[model samples]
Target: MTARATADSEERAPWLPMVGLFLAQMLMSFNVAALPVSIGGMVEDFGVPPTAVSTAIVTYGLMVAALVMVGAKIGQRVGWLLVFRVVVAAFAGSALMMVLSPSVAWVIAAQAVAGASAAIIVPALVALIAANYRGTQQATAVGSLGSARALSGVSAFLIGGTLGTFVGWPPVFVIVLVLAVAVFLFSFRLRSAAGNKSVDIDVLAALLIGAAIVALTLGFNNLNGWGLLQATREAPFDVLGLSPAPLLVLVGIILGQGFLVWTRYRTGAGKVPLVSLSVLGSSRERAAVYAMFIVVALEAALNFTVPLYIQIVQGRTPFDTSLAMLPFNLTVFITATLVVRSYERFSPRVIGVFSFMLTTLALLWLSFVVTNNWETVPTILGLIVFGIGQGALVTLVFNVLVTAAPKELAGDVGSVRGTTQNLASAVGTAVAGAMLVGILSLNVGQAVINDVDIPDRLIAQVDLDQVNFVSNDQLREVLTRTDASEAEVDAAVRINTDARLRALKLGLLILAGVSALAILPASRLPGYRPGEIPETLVARDGPTGPDRDRSTDGTVLEK
Candidate 1:
């Protein structure tokens, strides 16, 4: 079909399936966001530490990151529609498990199941969108995906907090079940495509990749608990008198490189690689992935940090946490949806760099503004500004990625997107937790040593080295047990407050530097303009000669 023909066909296209696809995306993101909100409730119900709940989040991310490439291959080998429907049913089952979970272990298992389902659904969304839409409609559909993610996060904080507060955390997952059913019921409206039987799934590469990601997540997740470089009491084991956390990270990097080498070997031998290397075949696509990882990672960091501060440190309700986060999350949703409107007026280079600059500035602003009290105006304004930058970058990078690749490889694109995003989320949350706690320990020790009010002899009595985020109330209770005077306990509380706040400010400043460095990658983003759809489509559908009718007329309708 020509431009006019494709536009006409798009107008006649059924949009009901897009709703199902959008909901599928939302289901995954909402569940991820819901985990943090439910941390307080889960800690109370299961009598486990917040770290235990944090494990469930990491486990889910690990599963998705490890299996998503294999999942993408599975979708191509099996028909996308068939695999999609099956996984949707599995996701619903996972939700049922969430509702009936008896322990933190059960919750982790349930999330792992959901992550496996999402691994497939993530890739299927891109493939399905490719199968169903073309021309400008396709661009809009892709852009809407970013908005769907932002919208899901917003809904999770609002709805999850409400349900976790009043009803319970289990009831919060009921929302996921509802969305799953809605997606499953409407999935029949999606266009079906034939499976490519010729493609082979590379199991060896899968194992290597899975192991690499598992190592990476475990390493980062335990950086605080296990120790960053030296052995702490919590270290499961040691590596040459050094901490295993950093060792695992090193091993993960080596294994990751091995996977790349293996893939090249397979490709050189004329075998079908698990994922297409061409997805990041260009410098531009590689840069897009790099930038996407940083933005998403920062987003994950903020989402985890803010909630942990409010609900855990401040001992506030989830509702209060939600109220504090609403401005930022709501801004992300609105900006993600609206960012595409600027595509025609501004190049992605301009938008990408500007967005990174905005995020960098916002984080700097937030570093200065954040106090123990997050409800203040300056902090909220900083959050809103950061959200706008975050929202725009996510959508913009995604669009650049999708448009740069051929439509036939949409599943590969989706798999790459899923892996990068889930892995980033895992790394981001882990690093944020680790960095803050690490800094707090250092600051606390220094405060204890330097302040005459907090004598060295008194600090020596306490295990100040194994520091973690504790409520002021909890700290007071601990200090009361110690043979300390009233003035001493008060000083300890003051020291804890000042040190924790100082650590957070330092973390934000470091993150601001990272955001600033990401401007380099953003500079390399694809420069395809919105109206360049004709050229992009031509690249996909091929020249308008012999294969014109067969390729263009029913490109999406092929079975």
Candidate 2:
């Protein structure tokens, strides 16, 4: 039998099934972007505090990190096509629930469901791509998947913002549901070709991993609150938000991770662990994984901060903000496709270095150009450059990681990649949020000093604690509460604007500096020609032969 026949005797062209999978994956990516845009509306509709509303975001990441490996194992057991279709259908249903949700609790529940489904769908797609395509074609499929994800991200913001403005945020979920349904219909064509095998899932390990992720993410999320209170306030008998005791969360994280390590060590004697920590036992893969974290952190920070700047500082409406980002998304989609096609021709290291250089330069340009009088043209151009660079960098990294792994171990590799990406995103958000808050606070204090014409001695006498951050509503409230004249309020407004602008500039500068550091590791990526399989691919599982049918438990079939 031919390789294609051996791989999937009943299926049609491999590319067709891949296309369907890609579209389903896009729905998950879309939700990630859409939630941020709709967060404010959710806050109002659900009457929840900012922290509570933000739970939707944290829970999504936590669920993906906790369950992705389990999902991958399940897919390998039942068949990728069955798992993909079922999970995607669940995702679509969850989205519909989100659209109809009337309360914050409902929204959180829906997001959790969606997140779990997404975790299953994503890793399965990675395994499916590995099984179906080889060489440059494999690289292209991976790149295309990355590009599609990026595009969906951009579209989620644009579409969600626009739809929310006209019909409210609920409609955005409805749109996602429609798209998911289309993908599901197409998935039917791919069923026969997918592998059906059996594997035992480590439920206890899954629980431990989930606990570890939750503790770690919650620790980072509350880090600022903890730091601020550490000096003045007594440490809560319960640390952060973990119950039972003051160091409960910290203890849980350490213990849970320890349990995971112990479990993996025990399992190594017989069955493969949920994630093969052994993959990074090699020096090269360790460095590659670290590089992946940095790249993801940078991307996540940029995505979060830039949109806020455009909407708040520039006074652009949400819809307009999304439209302004189109240039960036378009550049990413086009350039990423080009890079994937050409990656084999150049070293990944060379491509990665160039990508980082371009991204750093773009961020630097953005830092200079983001002013009170910023225009769409220059902002869009800078974003375009950043997007292109990020697209290429991410695609190259994904290709390297996937190709480096043994075929039997793709599920574990995908889990690690997914986990790293989520952890980086959570950390990046916390870091950026803290920096932005600190900068704004400083700016507000300076504005009070520079823009206010109040007597210096009188200003010194006023309690700084009495002053609040100046939002539009806060400005009005301050005018009503204070005995200040109209001119004084005007002066205060000017000072506030100056402080905000200054803070934005400083934040952008910091981001640019961080992006520049990516260049160092990117320079170390190995250069392999397009279409040429690396020595790693040849070493372990050479070309899969016709007689090699295997169960998910890694047992070869006797044909």
Candidate 3:
């Protein structure tokens, strides 16, 4: 059958296409949540410190943020359908490499490639929805995608913990590979839509963005280890001989960013710049973008810190921690889906403002109520409320951002949205991680100062440099074997508890402040209801005649 005929005659249910897209999106989303669950196993398998193992997560976020625009440009140059197929294949290959990775470095490399490939698929999927659906159909498609992402996160925690326990960390990659293959096969059934004309992509622009992102990420990652006030540090400021350079890296980031801005203006009259600062010239759109950045950053920080608090402070296993947080995701999925369907009945601005308020309140409550008391109920309840608020907030922002852009510029706007979210996640994780490390270090130092009865020689033999690498279990074992008095063990426990509680309080406070800032932009969101039909559509004036095309049944195409 001719392509036009097939497009018109295709009788598949609307939900079928949405389901396939959701599965594809879920595979990518699952990896984000799964990596945290397998962090311990990864450290053991690769024989690396926990901090080193975490580089994989940090690099994945950086790569995704850095390459999203490049990926979108490639899709527009090629066909979105073609790019989608290639990306799915690349994702599978990357996952396979990760499964067989022999070292931490190889694992990180594989993740980076997979992250970039995943970046390509996300914007393409959104573009596909815009091409294939209209009106309420398009809204439903977008909502399903958002809902699937939330549900995938919840599944990742549960599935990763279970699989990692029995089958080991490598099996997590294996599962991802299998899912990628399924997505690829399903995508083959997609009918090709109208192709996007090729656009010039500046290679130099891509490189500058990637370099800036890496430098910023590394700098933030090192902030705690290298004191912000310390200006003259070594090649990498040695924190217990584990080098983390904050200042120099941040300087490089600033320089690179400056270069990018200069280049953008220099090449302005030529082909369109990779990112047009003009988009931000719109006050409403700019506000929405900034709000998204803050909301994602806050969510990322809270997600990272809360799980650590549960496992380290409360002494829960990974499985128990995952289970404890399940309700948060459940609430998010349900509330977000409901909000998407009924959005037209309420104003987007009102919904967004209300959601941000709830999120801020939840964070503040968490900061006050989370102590060493192991109070799981209050924490869980707070998280559930936070999750619902976050889900509504994100969905509302995404819909507003995508719909507000000119139809011709949809691809560009989607690229910006994806990249901004990735960068926000990286920044949030790094900041929260640095704070946690700092809290741990201070507690360790205090414990050492309080120790009595230790001989001067024995005290000298104790290596402060090794303390950062020591796990809680290892610390307990060390104290047990040292012939220390019960008072010493008690002191160690107290120090650990105090450090964890302090970290949680500080992290939640940061989240609350950031979430509150979201209101400023959220209040400016277009006051339209959700699922409102656009007055115009892309390609609305394109040619239509018998010579142009006709369906097999000789009816004008509807899709």
Candidate 4:
């Protein structure tokens, strides 16, 4: 009798609703991709160091990691359509705040709101797909989420870079506002799902998991600014003569264990838990997670390092940053979308190993070939190779994990993916920041000591230990206060430039080693053939046979 409700039922599996979902995914990822490119502009506008912008990046990721599970439960309780639309509106508000943010602090606050919106949006996207589609269509929709993310990265670098270079950094978020409104309007095409009023929110488990993420994020994030093990001058407090960073990390680990123990207890009592432990209960699943963590972390590190080098060290525009990074971003988008087509031909384990090797080789080659110029042919080729590897791994591991689980648990899989990805991103960016600054300090001190032209007094005038990424113009401004001759300023500039390049090269080598070591986990991935997602409840170890053989193995169909 109702026309609107009938139309909603008739438009089942329409492209419009999927467009809304894809744009939502893009809205979240594009903001993140653009942030790094705008680092130079933000630093110039706010008159802050690069670490300030880095902290904002970490803040956004930490918020998502801390709240995504809870966001999922809230979505189920309040109804997906209602929750999704509300967050989209809130996301628009956050974008407006970002556009008007007068200081870096406001920028951080805006991203905090955006991250909170995304916590719900990430899980909601998967839940919507499950509710709307079935069979091969459902699988394709799920796979598209990965491509949407990669494509948004490409769009962000191009669009955000152009705006940041010619216009201003504030305008980068204008696209987010536009997309949020568009998604909100098209969201009506999605089928409606009723809220489950009986679902209980697990508060204790929430606190434990949230605490664990905060402590871990803070501990890793402060390693460079605060002392890794001992008290540094920048540290806020120490624990019994030891730095609080390690103590916080220890606390985080303890809380994480506590959360797991509590989950087991809750499961025994037949009470709903924050996250289903069974998602990662098997070794195959755990290996998939480990592999996911490595690729995501490497991605975060490179994303941060490349922009910092281009903008601050080389004094390039964000548009130039876009052009320089375009080869990799475009390659990743293409590879992620096409990688799924190869699953039926090759096993995931085989593809994973090959991809990681490509990434490792690319990083090593880049470390050697990267000079002051990013437009060089060797650098472009290395980026393209790395992109292909990185993009393939991202899609493959995600497919392996999602397919291995039952279809009903897709929401849990999405939540796990979001948490692992954002947490790894936070850790990756923080670790890279710490590693680069730590290396830069070491090199600068050595260079200062070895070269008699730069005076010790000049080093004392500014805090050398608190070094952050700065442009040559910023460095020149700082030198204006010091009583230095023209030759002294030139010597300091050359020394800083050389030290930065050396530190970058060494840092890449370390990351290359990290990527190479990731092969151990990749080798542990399940030996399932392509296009085979086990539908039945697998053995505690994992399924041994292909999809068709899974039925006769006495495997119970999961509820």
Candidate 5:
């Protein structure tokens, strides 16, 4: 049977079913990429602060991360195809709500709906691929999903920015609505297996994991707002004068440990766990997870910092931000699509190590040569180099995870991927923001104490203690309200500009150090090349399933 299937695959690749899967991935990516572009317009329309709009983004990630494990179980209980179509329809409704939303609260609610749908879709994509394709074709299918993400990001930034500027923010989401309907139409061409009615969801496991994810995400997301260690004015509640953010993170870790203990207990008792521990059974698989987390966190940090420097510090428009980022995004899209060709030539361990080296080098180069202007040739080259590494790592680690697990556990692998990505993203953004602000404050304070051009009175007039990332123009405007002479104002603006630049450069250096450390885990990836995935795939029961031996794609092999 496996021989016949292999011969059939050699004759024709299953490209048709992949179209729907690719589009489904793009549907989610596009919505997320469009958010930052639409922020300005959303603020204008809803008459709310930008923070209110950002809450919607946070809400979306929180929901997806919190429910993804439960969602994977639900997909196993119900069918992937049926649930996928239903979620696509639900996502379309969220888009419609975005178009008709009357207030900021409505927008937040709409994203929550979209997030729930995405939770199921994330895991289902992996499961469906496992069911539909085999071997090389399955590898190609996996790479295509990465390309879809990069392509969607590029498209969303360019298209969403244009639409928001010329048409309106509401019209940006209309594309989402159209894409959802198109994906629903395309889904008819794909195939899925029947759901297992005997699958049971452990409620206690679900609560433990979900609460842990929620607390972790919120804790990281609010590190800057609520303070990292001490309580801040923005903190809603504190414990013994300490910030709730770190406490929440500590609590999340404890809960996560408890969940793992419970899962081990369940598995030993011969009951099905929410996610089979076997999916992460080997050191190689665990290494893949670690590498994935580091790469994703690095990507998220760069994504947040670049736009922040361009738009906020340089006072550029969203269109300008898109244009500046085009090189990096386009490079990522191209590399992710083509990196699979190299799999035939290199082992996973080699590729992983080489990719991390590229990322580390790129960040170090950027730290030294990057200017305030993102469009400069040196800066663009550095971004392109980093993109190549990032694109390859994302696809490679994902393929490792997919090939390592059995067909029945593909959904679990997907859930793990989604959780890692969302958590890394939140943590990356928060750390970058906090780190830059802290560096800027240190630099500003030194300047004030040493530079004789500025006086104590000038510092006292403005809130120097809470100094933020601001542009020269903004600083000057604030200084104008004070009874200061031209020399004092000029000195203050110079300090602000220099401090911001120094902070950005130092932050990139720190990120480079992180990328350098990631090579350790990358070296531990499987030493086998493409088509050499191990024969010891784990089953729901133990080391092997009841049926005959199967390929990574779930096709039965000759016994």
Candidate 6:
């Protein structure tokens, strides 16, 4: 063998640094997953409604989405390693705050801090991986990030559920603190390029993008409460006669367009843009972004819907929620880790298409077979099938984006990925809730009007206009205060049960349709597979090229 080839064969990247990156990812995921698990404890402790606790979850996601672009630019200007370590320590502090929170307000504030820290950590993961690994090793590292996400989901649900049930909710966040500390210590092993002092921060671009993301996240999150069209009583404000939610969404879209226009102008003027548009320059890269958004959104919707059913509708415990979701979460973890092996055999285009097909079929199966009992054989099988698809797609689209960008612009790529994912998650969860509730309202209203057993007095006792998902037992309890006869109570309970099941089935069918539609974008993934894209093609959309230093052994180094 040639001397260079021999040297290359001998130089293997150590896997120790990856442990730190993995833990960093899990720290964020676990914190988010633990929120719902501890909702009951939080509600009891604070004497607030469950929606108050949910606001904390929304706050974290909104903060992350709003500031991630700015975070990426900051990381590039300030060294990634320095910023990463600082943010990891900050995350640890946030966990401590969570453990000692005196009120729901403090809990929200703690998550806000954690979200700000995560905004930096998200992009840092990509840049760090590029700094530490190359070729096959880099591919493994990228796939491991996806596995870490899946593994964290399972761990958070199982561990947080047990701890919250037996000990208390505060102990759950202690795990996050331990994880952050471990990541901080292990971070010493990672290598990063020096910060580029010349890189400019586009303040205008930051404001425009930040405002747009905030508006979009809030609009989507409040669609059900604020009203999808006309004004609802819960709406804080209205635009003319319509709900402010849709108006905010429209304004967000306009601001997003302005940001893009400003970015193109800035890039053409030879000034540093907030993010390099080159990340989305190619058709394949754009396709990867689209696929990533859809998959993440679908995953978020399922995560929200399943637990909402188990905990609220069926009145099951958090541990039961964990058990019901075990099959899907475990399958996702296994699939994400193993899918890297198939990259050598099948192209991204093939994998993307196949995965979408699997998701579509799985959702269709779920729509037909799912019942209130999530532990049923057919329901579990459907979840596993969906998990396989979700796992493969998550890793596949991420790898595609990672390979398409030159090492110098890895942070920008990371920012784009973060923005798409966070936005998609918000949209997915909002749409699912709105769609299901809307359907339920219709089903209940129609059933009440058509049933001959229902009397006007009983109907007047309930505010049909404020209908939402409630259990049969909850409905019965409410009716007890009224002079509802046994037959009337039974009728109301039957109507609620049928309406909820119908709504769930229809919602699943709608999600299946969305998965089917996403196949168009999946078809556009790269037709070829490579361990890593060549720098020549990656640099085609921008001025950046082979501008980084090379070691004496001729290995490409991060810049």
Predicted structure with the largest lDDT when compared to the true one: 6
Overall lDDT per candidate, in order of appearance: 0.84, 0.70, 0.70, 0.80, 0.88, 0.88
The window of 10 residues in a row where model 1 has the poorest summed lDDT is: 550-559
Clashes of 5: 0
Residue lDDT tens for model 5, 1-559: 0122333445355588889999999999999999999999999988899999999999999989988888999999998889999999999999999999999899999999999999999999999998888677878889889999999999999999899889999998999999999999988988889899999999999999999998998888888889889988899999999999999999999999999999999999999999887777767778889999999999999999999998999999888888888999999899999998887668888999999999999999999998888889999999999999999999999988887677888999999998988898898888888888888989999988899998888778887668789888888888889998999999888888888889999999999999999999999887656534344532233343223233334432222
- What's model 4's lDDT at 509? 93
Candidate 3 lDDT, 55-96, residue by residue in tens: 888778877877887887787778788889888999899888
TM-score of each: 0.92, 0.84, 0.83, 0.86, 0.95, 0.94
Over the stretch 238-264, how does candidate 2's per-residue lDDT look in tens digits? 434333322435755786777567666
TM-score of 6: 0.94
| Models ranked on lDDT | 6, 5, 1, 4, 3, 2
Q: Which ten residues in a row have the lowest lDDT in candidate 6?
A: 548-557
Can you write out model 6's per-residue Cα lDDT over 135-176, one digit (the tens) per residue?
667777899999999999999999999999999999999999
RMSD of each: 4.5, 6.1, 7.7, 6.2, 3.4, 4.1
Candidate 3: stretches off by over 4 Å = 1-13, 189-197, 231-245, 252-270, 373-375, 439-484, 530-559
lDDT of 1 by residue, 1-559 (tens): 3233424444656777899998998999999889888888889999999888878888788889999999999999988999999999999999999889999999999999998999999999989988888656666777788889888988888898888877888888999999999999989999868888888999999999899999998998888788888978889889788999999999999989999999989988999998888767666678889999999999989988997899779998878888888899889989988887787667787899999999999999989989999989999999999999999999888776676566668898899999898878878988999899989989998888888887666777789777888889999999877788889999999999999899999999999999999999999765545543334344344311222211122231111
Q: Return the candidate ranking by TM-score, descending.
A: 5, 6, 1, 4, 2, 3
The prediction achieving the highest TM-score against the true structure is 5
Runs off by more than 4 Å, candidate 1: 1-12, 533-559
Quote the positional error of residue 74 for candidate 4 in Å. Answer: 2.0
For candidate 4, report its TM-score. Answer: 0.86
Model 6 CA lDDT for position 262: 100
